[model samples]
Target: MVPTIEMTTTWERTCELDDLEPGWGEVALLGARQVALVRVGGEEVYAVDHHDPHTGAPVMARGIVGSRGDRPTIASPLHKQVYDLGTGACFTDASLALRTYRTRVVGGMIEVELDA
Candidate 1:
């Protein structure tokens, strides 16, 4: 017999889908952590850490939202370091990485799945 582990996901409601403006970022408080919510188009949404890893500043919510080819990206407001919105991978630097959280929309509300 093989042993299996079950994984559970807890999605916390952050805000309404209409609350986020396209091509802009919004800050959402997930408990004590600050999360940056970016809405690319009408339905596509992404959630990432609001902290800027390079500057140690919680200002990612004010970062510029754009795209690198097909991948959506956010550039830090302080240093202009670009990061992939979907994977939190730094495009300008390889050593630094921004944390990302899973997000979904339910009943016209945005929800985020925090890491446990």
Candidate 2:
């Protein structure tokens, strides 16, 4: 699928706030896109690609969530590559990165703004 390059887009409800847990992740389907949703603490929610770019495996939802310095991160289960949950920057490598979605909570539901 072609990715849209527009400046901004509408927010889509991905899941309920109760569906996630801290230090863990879940998969959410956004049309053809597969996203990994994770709840850190309080009402903070983060979204990234479910597929790991390094291993080409759809196991990012099972990745371990933690912090690398000041950035929250998810380490890939396959190769132990740490990726920043906020910016999707791979801490293990400067060349690799994950796609992060903008997330927010509204009325006890989680919403993500997909790039368009």
TM-scores, each model vs. reference: 0.92, 0.90
lDDT tens digits by residue: candidate 2, 37-68? 99998899999999998978999999999997
Residue 72 lDDT, candidate 1, scale 0-100 = 100
User: What digit string (tens of lDDT, one per residue) describes model 1 on residues 1-116?
Assistant: 99998777689999999989999999999889999999999789999999999988999999999999999999999999999999999999999999999988999999999755
lDDT of 2 at 33: 87
Lowest lDDT sum, 10 consecutive residues, model 2, at 4-13
* Model 2, residue 89: C-alpha shift (Å): 0.7
Structure candidate 1, residue pairs in collision: none
The clash number for model 2 is 0
- What is the C-alpha local distance difference test score of candidate 1? 0.94
